[model samples]
Target: MLFATEVDAPGVAALERVVLDAERAGYAFVTFPDTPRRPGIEAGVRAAYLARRTTRIGLAPTLHATTTEPFHLATQLASLDHASLGRAGWVVGATTAAEDLATVGRTGAGDGEVADVVEVARRLWDSWEDDAIIRDVATGRFLDPRKVHHVDFEGSGFSVVGPLITPRPPQGQVVVIGSDELTAVLDVALDVALVRATDVAEIATRVAAARAAGAALVFADVPASFDPSLVEGLVDGVHFHGGPPPVITASPHGATLRETLGLPRPLNRFAVTS
Candidate 1:
């Protein structure tokens, strides 16, 4: 398991160096952009670039969720997963601010609704089954039309067209982690479960709940301001930590933010990160 920070904006030059260095050094993942309800387009592009440079690394936002087009988000994830050979995961959240509410031009999607969207996204990932695309230019055939599948997803707050612009992801599932607020629900239905707990007992409780919920993996988020003395007693499988860079954030490596954190790869790869 690799622990990385979720910044509010894209750190292009810094991110480039961080991700490339991590890849070169065998580090697994680097979280680049993490906007609230604004949109992850910029962050997603940067993360994709990181994916393109490395063979085995996962890219995600610490706290990223979009009220943006479901189709667009799914397509982006597919494209990234394809580029990364299925190394994409999303630590998603529900929008709460009124301003964020207006960004999607719809009512807020609470935990349940966001979870439903996640379900839709997962379904969309499977919209076009593997081997669905058979590109044979010689016969004037680019793709086997019959292979495409329209999910026909019609939800209360969102609706999506059938098949995605790309094919299915290699992993068949992207890491989906939730926060402390929705851990219980996410643990039950999500692939990747996350929580911000204060102690070993809390961590154990969350992890157990996540496992009971059938999660693929569980992660914990930590901040830099925490005292190292306080980190002595807690025992957890993994912890995620990050801030900006030395240029913008405090520690050059953000080591002060957290330690003993990991990122899960293929499954949960402990990631050393930016």
Candidate 2:
């Protein structure tokens, strides 16, 4: 299976070293934590910067669903996908604390609101079809207007109209990650489900439930010192909290996040089907 870890810091160089070491150690992805009051660099900004520096590891940053504008988040993520050439994922969460809401000048939101934000993000990602950008300098035409679809999304808390400023991502859609608490929202749309149980039996139960609910991948948040392979069959991957990922060996040949995760490169949603 795949392995991952979380790294957080104020210095870009330190962050880069941790990520690069993780990649060298064979971790499939590196994640950054996000919270309204979190110290250090913003996760999205760090991921974008890391995207330019690393090639194979997935660059995923935590995205708060409640406070951020869905449309902007969608575009930023699409841009990250371009920067990383397909390796992009969003660890999405709803704002829980009142302070976080206050910081964004918004009211607190629940999982339902978070789910809506995610849906809007997905809609916007697909708004600009893959071939929308035709950049045909010879014809003097830049895009096929017909290929861009208006979202016309009206959710309980927000509404968005028209095509996204960004085109569809290389992964077709950037991977959407959600925690176990939001399974109700995630089951229908998320690409990965994250669980925090350390017990093997509990982990297995969570894995079965997530799979039954239609999650394509289930990742257990493992402790730094634990061996991930022991539970490899129970879950699709292990996300460690710190340093050299336990058990999983680094790949000398190098591999992309999709390759390590065993997920195929998704066909563009706008691609013509026979």
Candidate 3:
């Protein structure tokens, strides 16, 4: 089983220290939880900043799908993947809290809104094929326009047209993660599922449901203070709330997050596979 942790440090210095420590301790990834209660640096920006500092460890930042613009969100994440050399992940969040909605001057997102946002982001990532950037100095051409296709995603609340401003990320697509509860309710596909439960029985049930919902990896979200034996063999991995345990045997460093997670690089939808 793999181990992961959350780093919610308030400042860059503190966050860097904790993240480095987690990397040393051998955790697969460190997540930054973004919420109204914990007001601080944006999660994606934090990940981008640390992308230069560390190697091997995956950086996943939480972003609310409900309020954020899908086009910009997709672009930002694609850029992060580039900055991190394909070691980026996104925790798709949906919030209906009064304060959160008020901050964006928007209404609450429906049940499937998070899924819609995820789908649109995936499409945008694929809109630019792998070889879209030809950069042929001889012909004075930077890219092949034919290789970049329009996504034309129309969701319930908003619509995105054509290709993303950013090129396709190094990983083709950044790994997508969501809470087990959220994935359970919506028909969303996730690379990883964070299962939050108080005990083994609950963890098992949630893991089963998350797998049924098409999550490739299922991890239990355990509190900072908890029994390790209760969940060791039950889930694919464990995501600590405050931090990881004191002792962890690090896994072999994989070049990218998807590589570390044993997920294959996705085929570019816009690529011509003749």
Candidate number of the best lDDT: 3
Candidate 3 structure quality by residue, lDDT tens digits, 192-240:
9998877789889989989988899998888877666688787888888
* Candidates 1 and 2 compared by TM-score, better number: 2
Model 2 lDDT tens row, 7-52: 8755898889888888777777888889977776778999999997
Off by over 4 Å in 1: 1-10, 24-26, 36-41, 62-66, 183-188, 224-237, 244-274
Model 2 residue 7 CA deviation (Å) reads 1.1
RMSD of each: 7.9, 2.4, 1.6
The TM-score, computed over Cα atoms with residue i paired to residue i, of candidate 1 is 0.74
RMSD of 3: 1.6
Higher lDDT: candidate 2 or 3? 3
* Model 3 TM: 0.95
Candidate numbers, best TM-score first, in rank order: 3, 2, 1
Q: lDDT-based ranking, best first?
A: 3, 2, 1
Clashes of each: 20, 0, 0
Model 2: clashing residue pairs? Answer: none
lDDT measured at residue 268 in model 1 versus the true structure, 0 to 100 = 12
